[model samples]
Target: MNSESAILFTQCLQNDFTSLLDKYDPLPNSLHIGYAEANRLLGEMVEDGPVFSLMDWAYEKDPKQLKLIHIRDWHDPKSKSQEDHLLQFGEHCLMDTKGAEFVFQSWIEENPNRAEIVNASGLNDFVDTNLESILKPYKGKSIRVGITGVWTEAKVTFLCYDLKTRYPEFEIAVCSALTASSSLSMHFIALDQLKQILGVNVFSSIGAFTEFLTGDQPNLKKRISTNARIASDKLNLDPKYPITDLDKQILLYLFRDCKEVECKTLDGGFSGNVVLKTKSIDHLGHLQVPCVVKIGNRDLIAKERTSFERIQEVLGNNAPSIVDFCELGDRGAIKYRYAAMLDGNVKTFQKLYGTMLDGSGLDRVIDTVFGEQLGRLFEAASTEKLNLLEYYDFQHKYAKSVRNRVETILGSPQNESTIEIFPGHIVQNPCLFYETDLLDLKEYNAISHNTSYVHGDLNGANIIIDAQDNVWMIDFFHTHRGHIIRDLLKLENDILYIFCKIETESEWNDAIVLTDFLHNQEDLGIPLSFDPPREITNEKLKKAYRVHRKTQIVLS
Candidate 1:
């Protein structure tokens, strides 16, 4: 942290971070001030300054802390090797603290810190050879790369392009302090790489990208890579996918009781669901069992874990039992498990009904499986005693937000004409505008005489129907206590409004059946039901529905 170095850091930010500053508007002044403060502190510190470590003090402050740009891990000088390699990444970081520990043979294997700390260049042949075994665990996954010290431009280039090209399935997340003028050269490309890992194509170049990345849209960046699409596409647990030393060890731990375990990639999407079937020695003899493993974002897995505890508290034996749970590392991985894979999920049923919605079997299956389970869930949740009155107030606020979004759309000249034509089209073909009106209906007041804990995002996709017609809820990403309106509306709207907008035949028929169920939902056993006054169904509500529907189509 010398004066020359301090001046260099400030200059680099002024240049490379220009687009980010302009895009955020507020950052130009705040960041300059932050950097000035940071430069002042550099006089008393060395390589890693506490003042600079806060990240917000100097570089662009990311309010959500959405991106983990770099990481560092060092060995004590007194260790057996007596030599320090910069924070060695891959296996060392994954295993030294968590995952599983490695056992060494003899002094011949004394080289624990074998891989050199990668700098701003290519991986050496030794690193190329050893990195395979280390990264094998993350073959079709994302990982956090560690930089021993500060990250330079060349290092960023090698990481973003080279590492990405070499390991296409593996996404990279790193945390590091920016250093040297090197980063100034490729900051734009680095932004692309960052957004790519986040599974977004928002920035075609440095200019367009910074607009949103530095704006007041913290939630969007936080949610960028957390979607099911990325989760579904990346993981490849197929046995044919290849395994290395560490992969075998992981398998052994996962199937501790099993011998001759064979894993195969299932049709599960995102959220990393794979089936592991194996033979185990029991009291009688060898027996076969099937278990499902889920590896995904730590937050989502953490949510499911919490849901498991709540289910056990309220609906014991009604849900799948959790087999295991573990956090891989900071900005790395999270694993989840269920004792066995069930018959099928609601998504499977929806797909099936997509072609066979007219069939009585599909209708009966939905009623028998979903109806019964939902009844029990609501019954159990009813005992929780939530404040429904306050929940309605929150719903009104949400409705207002939706209205604001609609007004924004209406204010845009490009959308004004489209809004004008919609009402006329609605009158000519009410069926065509049926879903639109439903969306427009903002009368979300009134509480069902019954109140209970509502699954915050209960869509057909989240519900799983098993062989015994038992229902298991997955992806409890949004779970809260309130009126059951959220769950019921989400299910109905997803099946009818959302799916019907894109799908055809049985899918539409399925929507129709679901719509009928909603209109006649008296016996649905949901704790909360609502009735709204005419005044509540404002013009903004309708416009918002239209705008939201259009946005969904475009984004999807």
Candidate 2:
């Protein structure tokens, strides 16, 4: 292997061993190995060979000096087989002092070069404390120390007390020794005592410890930062919008405007209503205020708040729209903005299979909206058409540059395939399953045709209907040049999920009819001949529903 590859492998092994030692206890007469599989594999490699054959081979050749021989709990049965025979012979010989001395001499004579001959009873003393000390600097950093010995109640109490007092910040974990015919009652009692003494908050599972040390823990600070970024990105608004001077100015103007209005306070005086009589349109949050703000002028919907319009011109249209921000008398404060339709109306699917929408009419409306978007996309792609080879070169160049960011947001690519499309398909039959065939289409387009700008998140929630019943889109932060089928697959998947929840055969039939109309939209330009229709089977739907139910249970 190349040096780079070898170094990577060594790092992985080090991480694995370091992780194991952190969570488990290495006790006397008990095995201390990184993983059970490694120990088992090693034993199998040297089962019929000379003593320490595998160890000698690995140590003699490897430059990292990874010469440690570890016996794990699972291999104790095999290790005990040899130790038991020796003990039986020694016990018999011990009946006579001269015989016992002879047995010992013969045993030492056979293995003169051996570092130590330890039995189950004496294994604790054989523990290499110096080896543990070598790992001390790594403590609370990445490596977890596992100390296993024949544990007593008193020993457990003292150990927990000493460790908590000595290393209060360090993540200390413990696991009981698993040996032949071992009873864990004492271990359980010791664990309970440790928890009571050390405080239960510090206690965590091995997996939790690993995640915490790796910086994967969902701390409040990390969560808030992540949420802020996600919200800004989803809205296609500037990241600094909420904290910008423009936003502050808009808030101050809104507060001033409200002060001029005849405000009405509701019961308990917690929330009040304001009626601002102004010729200028009130732009509140992202929505045109006339819709959400009752008693506002309907004709003034196009008007913008004075301060907001000035700031919008300066900061550009991408800044988040502010509504009202004011400090109430004696009360803390209040801020209101246009609540996203998705935030207020979008219901999370309780079951993977459930009637998501009431009827086929909804599906048709969705199909039409997406079809129009696809038409615009095709026009854009036509304007940028190039030769097949050049297109492929450009597609790959672009995708490769942004591949890391894409993977971070949408998850890693599962597989890549290439599609062979005829030239006629570009203008005459451009429709294809975009979401499911994105990677394939990208590769094919690079080798065959030009690409188009596609909305990456084309699911139903991104499609919104206003109070006026006009359909609008919200999230388009992931728009990129790709095939049209990506949008279709997203739409189909959404509809499929909704249809799968139909309770009756008639409902299923109607769903299929609606899906067929969507599948055959001329504006969409999808191929008529494609995958065969399958029954919307309920068994899979029930299973999905059950899983979703379980997830809700856990989340709640």
Candidate 3:
């Protein structure tokens, strides 16, 4: 690596801590220190999700720009720190064992020439290792050195202090989110000391560290435009969504002086709004905050703005605060700066379904979601009525997509005349419904219900849950008059099809029957019963249904 290049020296990402995170066996204090963190340290490396893996991201961005150095705790039989360490932290990281190996040792194995591996038995990485020599090349060259790992109080502290004292010329910084400790108190105290006494820079995230490394004077306009182009493909983005050059300029003026601005698309696409979650330093406060920008056509933005205002007025903190809105002739944007997000994130309702079900306050959870907040939110929005036929226009539009997907999975006849989904069941020609004859019955016309100013499209994907269990809903473009039970129906869909795990065809069938029976009473306004068909025996669906059924009954 050159003098101008940065070095990412990750420490103690060993199986001893990372793997023990999901086990029933007891762990040592050394491992517990990092495990007790609110956000698990180094978890991005192991987790499979939309998370940005710092190492992998760097590798993908440009492997040669950032050099890698790893520190692993290896305690051999004749190790130097064995006498003192044995009694203190107990047996761990024994040499030649998997516990002593780096959790991502394959990284070193794959890039043997680019990656450096240093073994240490003590808290300080420099204590009996060649980390100093490995870093000697970058000394006094104005290169940024980032340190991230476990046991932030001890191991992370010792390294930061020693690295600065030895080579004060090299800028040393720690990515706080990447580093963790088993003891929350000690970890924070150590970070405070590291910054105050040692003059070490503490970055809240990798984006900030990357910003410092690049030394960009930062044009917020350029960052937004650049990232917009990087994420230009419309696959995940809202269809036909465009952040026009004028829109980019507006975003620049909107998020003025924001530094380290990193932009990426979120998971869902609904309401003709393409959402981008971006992390940036607040110009006024100079603190990292993640803001979401929703870009859509002008008509959708205008409607959403009005809907957001109404929901915020009625629900108060239950709704996310709208940062600003930009009107760009045919297209516009809604930027939301969430105030409560310390780390600028909350788990999606889909991600935390298990947490909500397994929570201690079942009554509070049900009441808060169904009775108190969202129930009131549904009341506050609008009141429009449409019979099933009119609603079919929207439903049928969605069914076309589902039909195409099913055809892709199970090839149909060339004419699509008779598509058999099961042994005796078929989605005949046009409407793909098992009961295709029901369309001519004219019974759905008699069943009419007021689609109150409800979140027209409600789903677990757009619902947000924070650490405090407070709910936040997004994607307000569809926040107009809709079905009275639209929100509840969406929640049920998540509990059954989205979150519940049904392995066998029988289980899925049972889930379908259960959901259909329960949801069939939406127009009748009838009280629900918890009983299921005697033949139904899917324990996963049954368990999830029990939670949904109780909430549904109470809300209904």
Candidate 4:
């Protein structure tokens, strides 16, 4: 075996230990906490478990990398010593019974098999056992001892502490996913406590075993990411998106034909999904096909796949196409073509056209985008739908309609708003323009007579400009059979709030005035005047007007 190797210690994976999953009172002397959480850990503990997967990965794939030691929670049945084991957790894991046997059928009953077996009782696992003599050979070699199994607060914790102290040099890695506790909270708390001890590494997912085995740098930097995801649905835990090792396993499966593949988080992240740019390299070290991968909430990414477009020349124009879609446990993953620019620069409209007139913003390129690309998008919206009233309710009719659609965090509209925005700055509420009585059934169809499959959130960040200055849209979670007018309005707002970035009251006033002027121009069905009208001349605001004019032509 290699000197730099590893060993895995799986504890309490026995019939008797199954009592921890009892729904009611559980075992009379069991450290059972709650059934639901226990069962969640159980789902991955036994049949096709992550731990078992690691065991197979090390042995079946490359036994030279690892060895296994199964620790059975066995207690002597004949002993009337009246110790704490009999008093607290009474008569559990009794010797010569099914309770004390290994749950996995492959584990040898006696010693000297592929995997070594150890029998320890209650809290006395570290006391006077053959465990020390068994460790005689692999003692000095720098090896990683992987810890897994039940009652994280008790046996797992105690065993890890003993290993850390006795074999201080050995890397003590505890697979958080493989272990359980009397209570779910204790399981997490124990992990945190164990981290304080030196030479101990608590891996949140067993997928991280690869990092330990190869001494690879940690992929998901924030160890508490999984916990944070579970703790809150809305917490922006990390500024950057993270992918687990299991996610990599799935990606490897997808890109198996490629010699090697690499992934990096893309620029846009407001969609609550990690957009990764994946590039493949062949044996020659030359770049091959590139794609975009998105990992996010299962429901969201899965829903995104429903409208996920594939490579097709719909109307003689191409868009980023979906490559594949899959579920990573509770998260969903989908990959698409990586749209690159002529100069090989992969930039969003936001990065490419800052304020649509700033340093990075090239009017010549943007003009081609406006004259050609965006027009193609709007033209594709030929499919008509007669649901203007439904849009009306969403737009202005409902009590919570306007605020719910406009005032939001990160431009993501929430369902409610308690505070008014930009009071006395410009127009107080946008709903002022969408008055209830002003909306008429006769005008509903007249206002928006056309429809198509529109991007629900057509922000500049989601719009990708490619090599030929063509547009490739991404982050289509909200894509639906909808109207082009909605997309036009959304694009208009993206330029207004996202790009303009109005700093002062005067800039805000200029933006408001310019917006009103653009609206009038859009209604007029003509090109905007050569200059900013209505005394609107904030250099930045004028550029906004120019971009708005191009949109006006598209709308016409």
- Give per-model TM-scores: 0.38, 0.25, 0.46, 0.47
lDDT of 2 by residue, 189-298 (tens): 56556557665222212123223223221122222232221222222122322223332232233333222221221112112222211112222323233212111111
Worst 10 residues of 4 by lDDT: 227-236
State in Å the error of residue 154, model 4: 61
Clashing pairs in 4: 33-182, 341-467, 342-467
Superior candidate under lDDT, 3 versus 4:
3
Question: Highest lDDT among the candidates is held by which one?
Answer: 3
- By TM-score, who's the top model here? 4
Segments in model 2 whose C-alpha atoms lie over 4 Å from true places:
1-359, 383-445, 495-556
Candidate 4's residue-wise lDDT over 1-556, tens digit each?
A: 3443777778887666643354565553454435544454553224333444454454443345566777877677566653676677667777888667665645353334677678776575667467887777777767778888887888888888888778877878876656777655566678768888554686643445445655432222222232111222221222365555565554554454455665656653454567766666654566666777777765567556544431123323345655544444555566676445233446787777673453225555444444454455556666454666566344444545654566553265432313345665433444444454345433445353666656677777787765566567777777655665676678778777788788988887787777666655545455667667767768777777777656655456
The CA lDDT at 324 in model 1 is 36
Ranking of models by lDDT: 3, 4, 1, 2
Task: State each candidate's clash count.
Answer: 13, 14, 9, 3
Candidate 3's clash total is: 9
Instruction: In angstroms, give how far residue 153 of model 1 lies from its true place.
Output: 52
Worst 10 residues of 2 by lDDT: 4-13
